[model samples]
Target: MRKLLTLKHWKNTFAFIYKLLMSKEVAVRDKLLFLIPVIVYWVVPDVLPLIPIDDIAFTMIIAEWFAARMGRKYNIS
Candidate 1:
């Protein structure tokens, strides 16, 4: 546990989070990656209605797709 607190470990952690955040796969198919949100939304309708949930989800999918395409097109070496 102590080893995990080192600068190296923190750097690795940061890098992993950065990659996950930037990843379109995660952004779009994150449901596949993490189903916690889905379960929560289903279990608690008052928190997020089905219609609003669908709207937010579909919007994220489209946005992630567009971002992924643009990233690929403008990828730099």
Candidate 2:
């Protein structure tokens, strides 16, 4: 999607990730959600005949979602 690939979107996403990692405002439970994907991506087999998608793409989408949620919850720009 165009919205996802924009420079502004990436900037905001990275900013939120940095802020979340740096600040203690977010709960540990929520941070754990991010780890699940990483674990699955590495632990699970990456071969599928029908599905043709990259792990990095899924990770990016999840990152964007996390960033938006963090920004909304913390009222951070």
Candidate 3:
């Protein structure tokens, strides 16, 4: 568990994320959905009156979905 906290672990994780996002098998809508929460948080003006909580929650859900989908498709644990 402690080994995963190193920079190498993070680099590998990001590499996997990039591969997953760039895969041809993933639909454009799914890619767009993955970017939605991230874009919303950064483009703050459009999300007024609402706290960032919605964006955070959506991001978490999408991240979990993305991880599971990628793991299944790539046959990775």
Candidate 4:
């Protein structure tokens, strides 16, 4: 129906927004700080439990990589 098409369009729009959010120019520290609240919000609700540990770790790794790429290395030791 007409509503389905509109919903699909919105889904793509959100996907694009998410991609832009995770884009390279966002900075690593900023990503972690941003993702912290996002992850917390997604996890604390006990909803969207589909997020896996590996995926979460991978996201952090990517953020750390971006941080290093931006010349802002983090020493967790």
Candidate 5:
């Protein structure tokens, strides 16, 4: 978990996310799998009002998960 807290790790995570999103090899459906939930959450945070997580924090967490999952699935570095 030490890696998760580093600025470099997050930078790499965001970079990977950008690469995956932009790559034409990745299907639109796959891209939407990452984007839809994030957009929905940001637009409707009150859907889970009890949870106190900020919008950006939620996006970052989903981004990290999406990067790792897509990287493995797509054989992306």
Candidate 6:
């Protein structure tokens, strides 16, 4: 949890995400698994208006989850 507050951790997370998205080795379908929901959430925040989290916060959380899952699945560092 403490790591999440650091700028370096976020920079690395975003870098990993950018790398994953740009890699041809990862299937489009696999990439869509991360993209679709994030796009939807950003485009349609009212879908879950009860949630207090901000849009960027949601994206970061999903980004972290996606990075972890896809990294393991694709054996990416």
Highest lDDT, which number? 6
lDDT per model vs. reference: 0.49, 0.74, 0.65, 0.51, 0.92, 0.93
TM-score for each predicted model, relative to the true structure: 0.35, 0.71, 0.54, 0.34, 0.88, 0.89
Model 1's TM-score against the true structure = 0.35
List, residue by residue over 1-77, the lDDT tens digit for candidate 3. 67545768556665666777887776678678667767777567464746645655555455666766767866754
Q: Count clashing pairs, candidate 6.
A: 0
* Steric overlap count per candidate: 0, 0, 0, 0, 0, 0
What RMSD value applies to candidate 1? Answer: 11.5
Which tens-of-lDDT digit does each residue in 1-77 have in candidate 5? 89989999999999989999999989999999999999998988766676688999999999988998999999998
- For residues 1-77, what per-residue lDDT tens digits would candidate 6 score against the true structure? 99999999999999999999999989999899999989998877677687777889999999999999999999998
Candidate 1, after superposition: displacement of residue 57 in Å?
Answer: 30
Predicted structure with the largest TM-score when compared to the true one: 6
Residue 72 lDDT in candidate 5? 93
After superposing candidate 6 on the true structure, give the runs of residues whose Cα lies further than 4 Å from its correct spot. 46-50
- Which of candidates 2 and 6 is the stronger one according to TM-score? 6
Off by over 4 Å in 5: 46-50
Which rank order by TM-score, best down to worst? 6, 5, 2, 3, 1, 4
Which digits, one per residue and each the tens of the lDDT, describe model 2 over residues 1-48? 887779898877877787786778878877777768756765454544
User: Measured by TM-score, how close is model 3 to the native structure?
Assistant: 0.54
The digit string of per-residue lDDT tens for model 1 on 1-77 reads: 67544768555544544465466655445423334554455567666565555644543444345445444644511
Off by over 4 Å in 2: 46-51
Q: Between candidates 3 and 6, which one is better according to TM-score?
A: 6
Cα displacement (angstroms), candidate 3, residue 62, comes to 6.0
